[model samples]
Target chain A: MTLQILLNLVIGMVWMLLHDEWNMLTFTIGYLIGMIFIFALRRFFPGRFYGIKIWSIIKLLLLFNIELVKSSLVVIGQITRPKLNIQPGIFKLETKLKSDWEIIMLTNMLALTPGSAVLEIAPKEGIMYIHAMDVAEFKQSIVRTKDLFEEAIIEVMR
Target chain B: MNVSAIIEIIVAVMVLAGTVLSLLSSLGFIRLPDIYTRSHAATKSVTLGILFILLGTFIYFWFMHGLISIRLLLGILFVFLTAPVAGHLVIRSAYRSGVKLSDTSVKDELRDDLKKMKQLEQYHSKEG
Candidate 1:
């Protein structure tokens, strides 16, 4: 828990730096306020941490960026052509991940990627509905993306 | 126009265009028929729009302050990384919820394959 708070602070610092807005006093005050809010929310929700391994999260982040660049180019190409050739469709992807945080992370990752959207999550069936730009090849992509994300996520959460 | 003024103007135009595109995309999301179409609107429009806005910010910071440029780059990198994954998950959830396509859908290969497989199973059971 202490480590998580430290990590959040580091992330916030990085964010502040990127935006070129930094004040030491503001950072400290905001950090404490954020910590308080987090703890208070956690108490109300009463959920367990999935025990994320830092290395696994790093791996996921790396994989996510690589895919993001590739997908962004693909989307750009599709949009720039004289004739649009999008075959959009929804696909159900099964997951072995049982934790809410893991699922949320997976969903967020999908949403961040280009040409894909997470429409719904059915926890009862452990299934995620994803929209792919190229629905014709959705089965393959769905399996590939879900497997890649779920494996890394489950490993981290373990 | 001076170089700085020209750059500023360009950035301003880009930001305006991006905002307009983003608004149009959100409107499409609301107007679209199905989850798949809505996802298309949300993903494509917002991604491009945000990219433009960030680009404007990057240019503005680069010309005006010339500090913390790396951070702006990282911000772009983070947004570039995360937007598509969110769209994928939304589509995934919609599919798992049994969201149906519109009647005008021309081709549904997935449904066709499922139907074919069911027929095959029925035929095999009858043979047994």
Candidate 2:
């Protein structure tokens, strides 16, 4: 839904019309070709960015899906098991990520991964307080999850 | 034996599997203990289930139909973009309104830390 992709879609539709074939197949082909044209003409335009990092978005999405599955499994396992052995706690995490948007994204990532919820964020102070269902090995989870998501997010946003 | 048939099989499998995941998410939603844990069920599993379902649908149109359905792709992005934010908002609002953590929860490090900070603030106010 980025602006550039919207432009690309228009260009693709135009391309289909010009070719005298308005079928889905022709439209798709035109879209890919339009994308290539935009990529090739990037030097001339000097626009801030075309917002066409399709590959990067795909990779980021895959990372998200994998994390979602892994964490969902962990939480479900804890929930449905014979014996409940969870050490639930709320902990303050110091995040190097600055900006309200970045903090919001990070908090959402925390909520979506594992059984952790972002209770509050002190954005100016660069800290987020998170509540987790399983805090038995809290440090390890924090390290592994923060590193994975933070790295991926920085890359994707960049 | 053709490539398209194989692709169709893969797509079918993705769709079926995604449905199963969605089902599990709902099951978890009802079965989880409390609001805090229930939020976990609602957020993680449901979002992922939606992702897989969208992925399957996207591929079905893209590969099988030989037509890139950018709209479906956009729908996937929309879900991905919003799901977590909504989840975070729900939990944040709950905490802000003092929706209690489950009774079985062992520790509340934040509450203790906040109380200590408040005590320190009072002492500093007295000194000043």
Candidate 3:
């Protein structure tokens, strides 16, 4: 990260000299250029392509937005309807993820999803207490969450 | 109309859509039955709404003015990082304090686990 920032700064400075304007937009463009350079140089560095990880992370973020939009609309539907039949419950989610950081990221992602929040996480047990808005569809949600977010995060972490 | 005029119109529409989503979030906050679900409204919609607004602003500044606002970029990143964490903290505290689940709630697995722990503690105390 530090290396990337240092390289970006040098490129930004060079861009300012070329453009005759030392403003933010030029620097941002330079940063993008520097990032592309670094990404292209990934083969030379060897082992763990941070650029690929960032790409996967961006994909994860896009997936998050899709889930967010769908869930928000679902919750809005629930809110608007007269017959509210929400079956809110807290259930234990045991994840196969080993590291603390991975677990934290998973929990946070779950919190941001449509119908769930992490109430507590017991690392010793490798379980998180997730509160859900609707329990019936939770099985599906859990499967989808694991398939979408967890799988991508594992790729990003690796 | 010119190309710049069309861009301005697009920017205005994005900003308006963002504002409307935020208003819906507030309505959900007020209209939702319980704290747990309300936190969803507070976190998800608000985050997306602000993101839309920021994207519009980013386009306007970057394309029209030929300058980027570092602060705006930072604002988008800051919100993405902190909003969900803040909402999580709020609900976590509420649950820890023994806030009852909504009337519609079916079961609480944690409370059962707490009860089992308490029972184990009583048994150990008796032996000691």
**Which candidate comes out best when scored by DockQ?**
3
Question: Which candidate has the highest TM-score of all?
Answer: 3
Residue-level lDDT tens digits of model 1 in A21-139:
78876677666655555555565443433133555678988887676555555555555555655566656677888888988888777664656666656676787666566667445
Model 2: pairs clashing at backbone N, Cα or C within 3 Å: none
lDDT (tens digit, per residue) of candidate 2 on B50-94 = 777778888878877788778877887688678777777887687
- Please report the candidate that would top lDDT against the real structure: 3
Q: Rank the candidates by TM-score, best first.
A: 3, 2, 1
lDDT string, candidate 2, A1-158, tens digits: 36557778998999888999969999999888878877776676644345445566677667767777888787767766766666666777888887666676777677777768777776767777787877765557765888777776776666
Each candidate's fnat, in order? 0.25, 0.59, 0.62
lDDT tens readout by residue for model 3, B1-128: 99789889989998998898888889888777789878878887788789889988988887799888888879978997788899889988897687778888887899878677669889999999
lDDT of 1 by residue, B1-128 (tens): 78889988999998997787677766665555567766666666677678778888888888877755777678767776666566666655555467787543444435554466569889999999
- Model 2 chain B scores worst on lDDT over the 10 consecutive residues at B108-117
Better of 1 and 3 by DockQ: 3
Worst 10 residues of 1 chain B by lDDT: B104-113
TM-score of chain B of each: 0.80, 0.81, 0.85
lDDT of 1 at B120: 85
Ranking by DockQ: 3, 2, 1
- Candidate 3 per-residue lDDT, tens place, A35-100, comes to 788778766664654666778989988887788777667666666667766787888877777788
